[model samples]
Target: MKFYKANNMKPTVAALFLLSLLGCIEACAISLNAQKKYPYVLLGNDYGILNENDLGGFSWGFKRHPFNPKDSGGNYWQCFPREAIEITLKDTGSSADDIAWNDNIADLKIVVWVNQHLVHEYGMRKRLSIIDFERRFNKWREIMKKEKYVCLAGDFVNYEHKNENGIDMDIYEWLFEKIKTKKSCDSYLYSCHPTYEAYLREKSKEASYKFRGISHG
Candidate 1:
């Protein structure tokens, strides 16, 4: 009934429309849907929950998961913060029992952590005795040196790093430096305030605190 020409719109209004459209496209690009095909990391915690097993030496970082949605339980991919991993490591198995606890850890070829670092061969080993697993692990260690950075599922820190491995490495480093600067400032604040916890507790009651709720995976 009524059609308006694009030329009729004011310059500012037209510019705003274009900006909003671009924003929507950028937002859509970042999100992965169930049917989309792209490399993504699966949450080890979710895997453990679905399989009824312990997390077992798994820390937070990038991991390779099945590209197919059906194989990955669902199309949803979740990333947890590094703080969550610290809690999981302590609460989950950390000793000999850890080895046999989660079959998925081995079967899924998910890298296991040894002394807070990735042991590539542990994930590759199949149907081997504990002694043999250790021996072969040693040999694998000799053959492969540890990567400077190992991002795995559950690690919240390096998810943003982009490199040939689908992360921007340089930009990721800059983010860490920014975080470090913030932490340094926080340390100074802690030193200045004897009752930092009291201050935080009071601040928590503020309107800003209420506005920011904990994010779920």
Candidate 2:
């Protein structure tokens, strides 16, 4: 199990395009197999959900896709070809443990992408209580050990707060501290650099060219 701190770095357009092409090719190949095998599971917040229009027919790389439904708690469980699972946790009542414990997902690799809302909320709103939050955090720790789950991306609102802040900021800090001690977890801080600036410049040039073409057309 591994954990990674979130960063502002974005993949280059060329890289994204190449990945899409590769994914399409892989999907085609998987479709040919009669007995499918799923080895990857994507777990994250709503941002992880993929719509039909996002990748067209190759969304799951299979001719027949798995049933995607929202439970009463408003969480989405989408299973794709090869039995790959994509879980989107929208509400506090939803628990990933339920999906992870399923007999079908045994011995499979689970990849998690968590956002700030899962652990901390903004403004004066409270989504999960302190006790519940700690309980869920402990549950994840257990899942990490049992399922060998790797958290690829996650952001715990790391900031100082006072008692009146109305947010459980200390818990987030505690979570960060605990993960840092784990040998399997690696935490990092990203600062702006020249390379990122150059990437942005290139992206701007590409956008300018597209906009000009559209205007001329």
Candidate 3:
């Protein structure tokens, strides 16, 4: 009777072990899939998001008074190399909206820059702009070498508080309205403030265990 009971228990234990292994496999697969889908993970202070590329999609790089930053942000933009840009445009993966996701929150003008000099205004027109860009690119190449980054910069709206008679006023603009530029360029590289990153990691941990957080240790 004891032997019979042990035999039955063996099968039950084996079944449970197999189920657990399968569950682990599924979790691993999902993790890998997410990694592939989002090649670059931008870890924020309170949230983390995935992105296809890191060069020039949507950056919180430069900050200016809600009005003046737009011109500086819009004047200089960079993106992927010519081949990547061609592939992106061919696939119709690039969009003006991609340049600034918060356009609904504010108005902006941006330029797609191959470098400091070579540039084109990014527009979402129906026609393919790749060939036209190529012709001009080849012509420009005659003058200088090609670059490997796609960047955008122009007047992008930034919210700032102004002091008026000891009172603070919040300034903001809608996309339908134009943003004013600064007297000089004020663009900078994309960066994450340490305090902000720490905050994001803490928030992410509080939010979900599924997210990968920056290791302070």
**What are the lDDT scores of the predictions, listed in order?**
0.24, 0.28, 0.28
Candidate 3 lDDT score relative to the true structure: 0.28
When 1 and 3 are scored with lDDT, the better candidate is 3
Give per-candidate clash totals.
14, 0, 24
> Model 3, 77-105: lDDT tens per residue?
22223332221123233444554432222
TM-score of every candidate: 0.18, 0.22, 0.17
Candidate 1 all-Cα RMSD: 23.3
Lowest lDDT block of 10, candidate 2? 71-80
Instruction: Please give the RMSD to the true structure for each candidate, in Å.
Output: 23.3, 20.3, 25.6
In terms of lDDT, the poorest run of 10 residues in model 3 is: 1-10
Candidate ranking under TM-score, highest first, comes to 2, 1, 3
Estimate the overall C-alpha local distance difference test score of candidate 1. Answer: 0.24
1-217: candidate 1 lDDT, tens digit per residue: 1111111212232342343233323322233331122333222212111111111111112243442312322122231222211101011112345466432221112222221211111122124333433443343233223222122222222222234455222211001000011012111112212243555565668746556654321
